[model samples]
Target: MTNNTQSLNSDIAAMAEKEFEGVYGRYRITSTDELEVQRYRLALLLCGVAFTAGLGQWLMIGPTWAWLWLLPMSIGLGLALNWIHIYLRPLHQALKLLWALGCLGAVVMAWSVGTDTMLSTVTAEPAWIWAIGPLFAALTGVGFKEFFCFGRPEAIGLTLLIPIALLGHLSGLMSGSIVMGLLGSAALLLLVLALRKFGMDAAADVGDKSVFAYLSNPQANEAL
Candidate 1:
């Protein structure tokens, strides 16, 4: 009777251990995390498509039509910024803040001068770049982060191209043709970067979950 009781207790302990492992194992990805990653990837893809579509419309159709693409581009960017898992909480929050400011700036620009004329107004008054610059700045931050983590050439190119194009136009240093070329290149590079990310393991993008856990918990840091 005693032996049977001991065996039964051991079995129960083993079962409990397995259940715990299934739920909270170090390397295990919860369904929730997986779903979040999927959304992040989808947002990235949307951004790429929006960039390509906007550029194409600007070149082939009309600038007014291209401006419409900003809606989806902004949406995708905002979603990506929200869902992105950065180890440093402060940096992540800063990026989101920048995005918010950019959106606010865009709204002000649109309200001041109707949506159809916003692009032309900004082009005519380079000083207005200040109003819309934060959006691209946030985008540049994303590119820099991607390049730093993945060493992707397209990402680095995007990081550099955006500032150069915007500043060149803002300072009246580059011709319209030159600025257009630079922006077109940036759009292509962003599209390439986004598509390549889809082929990568989602786990790579999520990075080390332990770092996120350590950063989020003040008590854990205090214990350390």
Candidate 2:
């Protein structure tokens, strides 16, 4: 009877140890997943800013309001860049280089459009074409960076925005602002869905920990 009891005790201890190891492994994986999810959330916020800006532009809002969009957009961009630097320290320089290039390209594109506007023969419609290159480059660059940090689904989704906007432009069904607004809206929708899933997953992790804590705590049962 004593031998049987000792063997049973050993078995239970081994089992508990194995379970703990599995849980620790899962915790590590979940932590990594949570970081990616947060990064995606930031991306979503940036998309929201873009959507607002595009909509505001479409409505021909005041320049002051248009400039205000830049503040949020800049904040989002800074957060994204900082997050990338923190999590991907090795590629920080490369990402910064890409961002600087994108910004420069956008500035040049804007300057070209302004110049076109000043020309007597240049039409407003044709001036928009100059902006397309910078837009595509920026979107593709962002998707590429995200591909490294997140996964293919997000990267593909972000990249698709460029082509979708381009198609809208080529189709002539809507103006550039409307096309941008539509793309931003679509991106925002995807971000919201992804964020909800991430949030639920994180909540589950917390719930699991709570259950584990309750099960392990002698005081918890006494209190209950």
Candidate 3:
């Protein structure tokens, strides 16, 4: 067995050498730069805005002021997301983990706070709301890997956040209260992905390439 293992190791090393012989550089599947870093951050920010905006308007502005604050907030979020996408067109990798985690964190917040205000016409089920966090985390993990090439921060943050968001959404949705679950759920997916991708990027661009200043009191700014 020992001899066989040694032989296998030698063969594997030889094969690896042969495979890399023609390659110019090490196959770094995780290499990234400034623009990508910002992109991840951007995704998180957008997720938070949409999540809060969607539920906040539904709950905060009574029938009389329903369209008032919500519409403006929606429009503002849209514009800000777009602006961030364009503004951080040249960033890189150090920020990759930051952005992914940030986005995940944002979605978690959205589910927690936003779901509480969903329409009561058909009351959403706790089971369904409970599922939102895991779903968001899983999908975002894929997106982070697909778009940014790294997802440790995303995976970690999402793991920690899923349960919290589940609790928040569950409290609001209740049982059969809102029939908009299907539609609302779908909307959350889009909101989470887009917001994470663009929101953090624009934010990271604040103050001449300084992520530190950009993140200072981030949650306060996000909820406001």
Candidate 4:
């Protein structure tokens, strides 16, 4: 029984190793630390986009058609993020499609917001209704991806935007711009925290490797 169990375990381990190699065979990931850094960089870029967009709306920082810029900005960022991931590992087809849909949703949301603001007879309610739908849909895709791939905090941070938008519209606590700015600011804070955590984790990893090396070398232990 023990020999059979050992053979089964070896088979499973071999299959797992082969699968992992196949998945990353085409990509060159220098280290786990590099991958984590890339992920954090993507998060920071997204945080910047959210914060800038919120600030723009709050300050009324651009012309009525300014939202159109979001289409290109979102697509560019989505592509860049995906590019980074693809360089590190092979991506599922569904993941690629999700990113594409997110970019499309962003474009649609920007168009809807711009058009509604220009043409709506009743401004506040209709504008938010139309705007929130696409924004939430896009964010759902983002949150789902983040939850599965990046981290729970990022997913939760994005998911919170749904309620933030809904309550901001209904309660009239502040303008949409102010609410968005506040939420975006919160997301930015979360990103900062996540980055720091990942940095610390990487440092711990280095320390652990150093300790392992020292402990494994009998000569070094003897010198100590």
Best by TM-score: 1
Give a tens-digit lDDT track for model 4, residues 1-224: 99999999877755543111222132222355455545545554564465456445635653355444455445544543453332212343444555566556445654655543431211345444443344344434445454555466756666676556546665776675666565555456444533544444333212223344454467966886
Candidate 3 least-lDDT 10 residues: 21-30
Candidate 1 RMSD computed on C-alpha atoms after optimal superposition onto the true structure: 6.5
> Against the true structure, candidate 2 has what lDDT?
0.49
Q: List the residue pairs that clash in candidate 1.
A: none
Task: Go through the candidates in order and give each one's C-alpha lDDT.
Answer: 0.81, 0.49, 0.40, 0.47
Clashes of each: 0, 0, 31, 0
- lDDT for each residue of candidate 2 in 147-176, tens digit (9 for 90 to 100): 554455656666676566656666576685
lDDT tens readout by residue for model 1, 78-119: 998887767787888888888888889999998998888877
lDDT of 4: 0.47
Candidate No. with top lDDT: 1
Better of 3 and 4 by lDDT: 4
What lDDT does model 1 reach?
Answer: 0.81
For all predicted structures, in order, the TM-scores are 0.84, 0.45, 0.29, 0.44
Q: Write the per-residue lDDT of candidate 3 for residues 54-85, one digit (tens) a residue.
A: 65555555423332333333333333333332
Q: What root-mean-square deviation over C-alphas does model 3 reach?
A: 16.8
Model 2 stretches astray by more than 4 angstroms: 1-40, 60-71, 81-98, 109-158, 167-181, 190-224
Q: Which ranking of candidates, highest TM-score first? A: 1, 2, 4, 3
RMSD of each: 6.5, 14.4, 16.8, 14.6
